[model samples]
Target: MFTNYHEAIEWIHSRLAFGVKPGLERMKWLMNRLGNPEQSIKAVHVAGTNGKGSTIAFTRSVLQEAGYSVGTFTSPFILTFNERISVNGAPIEDEEWLSLVNEIKPFVDELDQTELGAATEFEIITACAFAYFAHVHQVDFVLLETGLGGRLDSTNIAVPILTAITSIGHDHMAILGDTLEQIAAEKAGIIKEGIPMITAVHQPEALAVIQNTAKEKNAECISLHDTCSFDEQQPTETGERFTLRTSKRQYPQLETGLIGTHQRQNASLAVLLIEWLEQEGYISVTEEQIYEGIRQAVWAGRFEKVKDHPPVYLDGAHNEEGIDRLIETVQAHFFSKKVHICFSALKDKPYKKMIQKLEAVSSSIHFVSFDFPRAESAEKLYVCSHLDAKSYDDDPRTVLEFIQKKSDDPSAVILVTGSLYFISDIRNRMIG
Candidate 1:
């Protein structure tokens, strides 16, 4: 058994060699061995190509504001692994993490001895989240965000009270399928029989897929546009404020720490989910509580400004859609400011297209590579980008220094974008 947090993390990472196996069979067995912890806790299962994390953050904050004990499980840790699982905004303590890992290690070993096969790294982490929520934290509601495509993601095993799809787009296309319809079908797999679903997908093909899936499962699917429409988004000193017009309500000047127009849609979805919960008599939360929750919710690494002087910001725009949103927000807010970009991306991403979008707006672009196995090196990206005058550095910190040095004007803005893994490393070095 692992005796400490470091050992636990080491053991978990050791299973990475097994890679991703997209199926719920192993997870089902693990949960059963752990007394079906997932069935014991109330949960809101969330999935989508983007905005799932922000939506979960908004819902979790609102629930907390309503005096409900909330547990959250998310992925691609922007800061630390502990942030991936939290209760009331505080991450799992080291002692709690070690204790839980020790308790579950034996069960995992027993699974290894059988024909069912050992759990993947994500599955083990997911099992730990279930055990923590159901047995340790005993939360009133748990926000479970799928680690990958909803159909076979590790977190899809939860028996949630409701499910939400933030937005459908092209991401993980290889695993989820190449076409929009195919990806939408994979995402729609989270809809459970008789459960309610909410989605922000407006794309016709994607919406039709989700509708059909929910219909087949006898789930009540509610599109955000059918219930509410967002408008009047204006960036503020802290974040942004927007208005939501629902069928039965008008939420004006809703504020949130998460920026970008897409955030308004996400926050609106959270509002709709809460109202649906109230209608079903599952949870009672006041409108005022929700307003405060959306305002107070802090989703780091999504266009987050971690520094003021010289104006350094970090965003997780790993995919094309995310990059588009990031670009729109940057243009809307920082157009007057001289923008210098420090970015990196995974080798698998359409970096050429993303870099082109950034280059159109930035005064200069600097690419930096982190330690992620699939990360595209800055040197290779520089030659491939064909940016005749842009800078390249293997070390992210040096890239940051270069951007700061180049942008010396008072209105200069130093921005960081690219893979979430790269952003995680940059955030740790710059802020931690």
Candidate 2:
């Protein structure tokens, strides 16, 4: 019923007054009002501090290869709002999204007018994705990624067939919790009773908390180490090849399009989850489908190479653990060059630790503001980074221009990293 996409998006944004209240009550109430569309479809709920998005991508690709109509919902879009919701890896069409928004506007408006106030941006988007997948597209399976923490996240409405916690770490401490144990407990909250809880390998403390939670809920706990292992292999520009060994099956010659050595573990976790799903009779999957999916899956902004000469790499490594991985990846791949870094992070992250890591890796650093309210200023970033960088730019465009001018040096590698919002801005500028 809406005339155009912009009008619909604007109307939805206008209704976002509640601004990210961390609880399931609002989502539950709104879903009840909208006929509880989330309950209509089977779901695989994924949560963690990091790697959840890439794991979701791998899972979706595998499911689609197995011939299921798959719906994937991820957060913090790199380019467009529609990128958050996808069916079979393609972003939702703008016109269709507009119509869908219009259809849901009256109910959403009523929720806003009530004592509940209004849904946050994430809540509205989660509702829209559920409605679209369960009601409109009628997908066979939905791969749901939690936006922030898992327990109180808006997307936790559905009782998923399988719940996955990809590697937990210290991110979103202000909202979730400060300690790894506390944050792991929040991520573990997504483990529903009687559902198989699949968790990536974690620190001992985090692992214990997740396992105890699974026990308390009478859910089956499957660890990455117990379920799967991998043979060490070197990565090539094309992809990395590794042999994945599951409890009952061994997959030889598995390849992933995503970079970074950490992704091998993520890919293994996805394969193991698929194995669990098959055992539970949730979906029948073939080895061929798994191989095909592994080969084709692509996730942006995680060590993604945007340019070849002068080698520009883009990553959304906002947290300490993620930054450690990013540092490792850079050292492994571009060891010869003293990395030229551009960085930014949100106010809530461990900015000091991240800056220290970058300082260790880079010869010179350029700080750029991402234009988000949560984004720290370039001057603040420079001070925190502990680097007497050659320059700093509040404007992202100016930073990019500086990089272009310096790009003539083939030995120089420009690494654009930090917050996902910063990654979104850089990606838009490059592709636009």
lDDT of 1 at 23: 95
Regions of model 2 farther than 4 Å from truth: 15-17
On TM-score, the candidate that comes out on top is 1
Candidate 1: worst-modelled 10 consecutive residues by lDDT: 399-408
Candidate 1 residue lDDT tens string, 177-227: 998899999999999998888999999999999999999989999999776
lDDT of each: 0.87, 0.85
Query: What stretches of model 1 exceed 4 Å from their correct place?
Result: none
lDDT of 2 by residue, 1-432 (tens): 569999889877775565779888878987887789988989999999889988988888898899988888998888788989999989999987887888777777788777877778788888898889877898888899998888899988887999999998888788888888999999999999998899994699999999999999999999997667788676767556889988879888799888887788788888988888889787899999999998788888888888777678889998999998888878777788868988888887888888888788898888888678789988788877666765777899976785786678878988899998899899888865
Clashing pairs in 1: none
